[model samples]
Target chain A: MSPDEVHYPGAVPPARTRFVRSLGLRLHVCEWGDPDGEPVLLTHGFYDHARSFDLLAPLLAERYRVVAMDARGHGDSDRPDAYAWFPGLIDVVNMLRDLGRPAHVVGHSWGGGQATDAATLHPGSVRKLVNMDGFGPPEEGFHVPGRDRDERPAPGQLAGWLDWRVANHSRETFRPCATLEELAERRRQQNPRLSSEWLRYFAAHGSYHTPEGWVWKVDPMAARNIGPFRPEWIAPGWARLRAPMLALVGSEPDTWGPLPEPMLARRLSHVPKVERGVIPGAGHFMHIEQPEAVARIVLDWLEAG
Target chain B: MTRLRDGRAELALHELGSGAGPTLLCLHALYGAGSDFRDLAAAWPGRVLALDFPGHGHSPRSFGGSYTPENLVANADVALAHASEAQLVGAGLGAYVALLLAGARPDRIGGALLLPGRGLAGGGAEPKRAEPEGMSHARFDVLLQGITADADPDPMLENCDRDIRPPDYARAHADSARLLLLAEDDAERPPWWHAVREADCAEVAPADPEAALARLAAS
Candidate 1:
């Protein structure tokens, strides 16, 4: 189960790995393709790290310099005392600044939301943006923190959350799996569309081997970081977005996202210039499920303008 | 009062005064703890029960360690249980939660004194929270007068977002027992301030909590 012993055949390691200071933490960054080529930054989803981009980054790197970052508290990045919903936006802006010029940014899930905010807040830092199904919960499922509606009353939700905190504080750790294959199998249950080989590769990079077993590197505190966020809040930012955007979701149902189509269409309507697409036979982790198909669309979108 | 254990977390209630009338349940500002209102509780007549919102003062970090309004109000509701009935005195973040509870548990909340607070008016670009390490003490002092020297900004930032405004303001103000007091110098007035057709809200040099409470007491 140790990292040194675990290996996934056909997995490609990044060309270079480095760290950059962000909000007093050293964020791990991975690079691929030509260092001199136009930069394309890849930010991963919740509980995922830069290594999650191993498949897509290489394809994007073929035509551009691909850089992926391990978001704070995930991967090799330094873990802070706590996590919040918007700090990722700050990190994205800082990364763009580190690039020293505008770069095309690609983000998945939570990273997609961060990338969208970063582009909206600091329009000059991003030339183009690609959001891979990070549109948050569907409007009907939206819960405005304190504004409890009929279906989900504040007391029950509050009690549930408090009970969760009592059980899982910052020091809480993920339950370890007996073996590396077990860990990959656990991930497969959540992301079933991903090939077993790819899941093994993902588990290897996303977890750590311990005397007890294999545990995820993601901080336990990251669970329930969504605070006071509303689906309506996203539209204003999208309306202000200056960069061209390519929004993609999987054609198939999955555990993570892609919300309903009418809802997706309405959400995308806020963007001044956006191209939307659905990857065939893919799920929430579309890029990993069908890297070639996902990459083909992303590459074409970035190159179109 | 003493810290009340609710099986999950310890709720810190700073009690003062005694005898007669509804308890003056004081909820401190975003960057403050129950201890911040010792002077107010000391001066107020009758029973006063000020709670250190969960994650503030002796109270432990909130459930899931999130200080979202939902969490804050939920924690405040636990404090509400300490009294048979109470009037709410909330400042800033506390006021935001007070308004929510006012509409939510109309029976428990007799009246609400909502002092100058964040996102009360609502509708603005999402407020960005200043990173804790990046914030200077001077800036911290400006916000809450350094009430708690180690006040974390994560919750403050989390509480002050685009959706901070009370969704049920009209319902919360269903009775004339609510007061929305904004600082005289508050440059940015919430849209609700102007939109309020006929609500008993005021904008003045910080309204005296005692007078507001006394007025509610007399009524």
Candidate 2:
């Protein structure tokens, strides 16, 4: 189908779509609100597109020019050969540079993690940062030994590792759905709070029609391990961020499950200036499930300081 | 979008572009993902289906850590089930597997593009040893530079921690049209290249993606 032919019924006022070339890949950016208004950048999580912000961007459009971008390998952006958090950080930095001014930045899930990294790595580019449950599993969950000692695969285990990986790679293939409704139903099962209309709208923009069936627009490679998941790999970024940061986690746990209170505190401890909040009755997808509440919280924070 | 399952391991398959032309089955090197062929897919006139070998990209880790040539060949067999007619373009470890696949399923594969690798005949001087436990992001970045000197390295290479004993290529055979893009030295060329009965081989600069594609098209 032609790009122009695709439409969402319950979508907020339509936004202009443009592409930015960064790090040799084309990134899709969607714009809303007055061009002269203060710019606010929005980034979606893994397997999600810029349109995932349809319900939330409009709410912020009144006072801020909101720009929602499809990270490489998702939505209309060109899929990079491999996915990495650093390149994503670079993309955000470039986008902020293009805006010609530091802007309020908000990220959801994987995007949230990237936003946190961006704010930390390039503080001058971000005025304020909001992370929505982006911190993934705690340091222990990564299974890598801490500073005490190093671990290495046993001598004879290499063959087994290779075999296991080949088997695992085969399973990461996209699963096709018979129809958009089917996709919506699957999504609904994951986040029941999302309305059917919004779910359908998300499926429409988040998936591509294939000869076999409808499949997510996300690149399968996006699911692969691109970097070490250890805490040392991430904590430095949190410590480096200079922008005022806010972390909004859902009341209920989702895929990553609940972050233990101690773990949450440990994760946030590195940040110098940060605040925390929880959205009642929402899960990991709090932005979509509680758009108004999230917008209000965000706006109130931005307006206060 | 097809799932090729073999016991505990499942391979991720990606099919891009569309046309009646020949399909290109792309296999990425060690620590590489199927999406590595995105640029090649865009340039090709035909369909391009790339597979993420088990434990590499989105695919599941093998229950047994089985990185043997036999298991890899089996994974390719399942990946091939999704395509009607396809050629093979494999890099590094992928190139080695392509050679094995061509030998195992001559009828299913068309022309083959094998990039830099010490072929199935195995035995290049042992690869420089790098301890995964001691790896830092900066050290990892240097490892990536060794793979491809691009200013920006492919993050997928981070998956290269697990190792496997190289397979002996001396016994493998290539029955179909095959193009071997040789690396700078014999260390990257399979011992079987000189013995392969039917194949077109060339030594091209590894950095030239266009030269490799041109060789594949011409072959």
State the lDDT of candidate 1 residue by residue for A159-243, as single tens digits.
Answer: 4554465456535358899887898897777677787888888888888866787888887756554234456656655777889
- The TM-score between candidate 1 and the true structure equals 0.72
Which window of ten consecutive residues has the lowest lDDT sum in model 2 chain B? B125-134
Task: Provide the lowest-lDDT 10-residue window in model 1 chain A.
Answer: A150-159
The weakest ten consecutive residues by lDDT in model 1 chain B span B128-137
Separately for all candidates shown, the number of backbone clashes (residues 3 or more apart, or on different chains) is 2, 35
Clashes of 1: 2
The sequence of per-residue lDDT tens digits that candidate 2 reaches over residues A1-305 is 43334455435744688888665567889999998899999989887899889888998997899999898878888764334455577678768867889899999988888888777656677899998888866665533222232242221122233344455543333778988888889877656667787777788878878877888888665654311134534554466667888889989866543467788778789788989989888888887788889999999998886
The sequence of per-residue lDDT tens digits that candidate 1 reaches over residues B1-219 is 588754345678877667666688888776578877777676566788888876667776543223455556656776777686787778767776776666456656666766666445443334433321223325423433322243454343443444444333433343333444433344665544443323454334235656665665553
The residue pairs found clashing in candidate 1 are: A165-B64, B121-B190
Give residue A234's error in model 2 in angstroms: 2.4
i-RMSD values for every candidate model: 8.8, 13.5
Query: On a 0 to 1 DockQ scale, where is model 2?
Result: 0.03
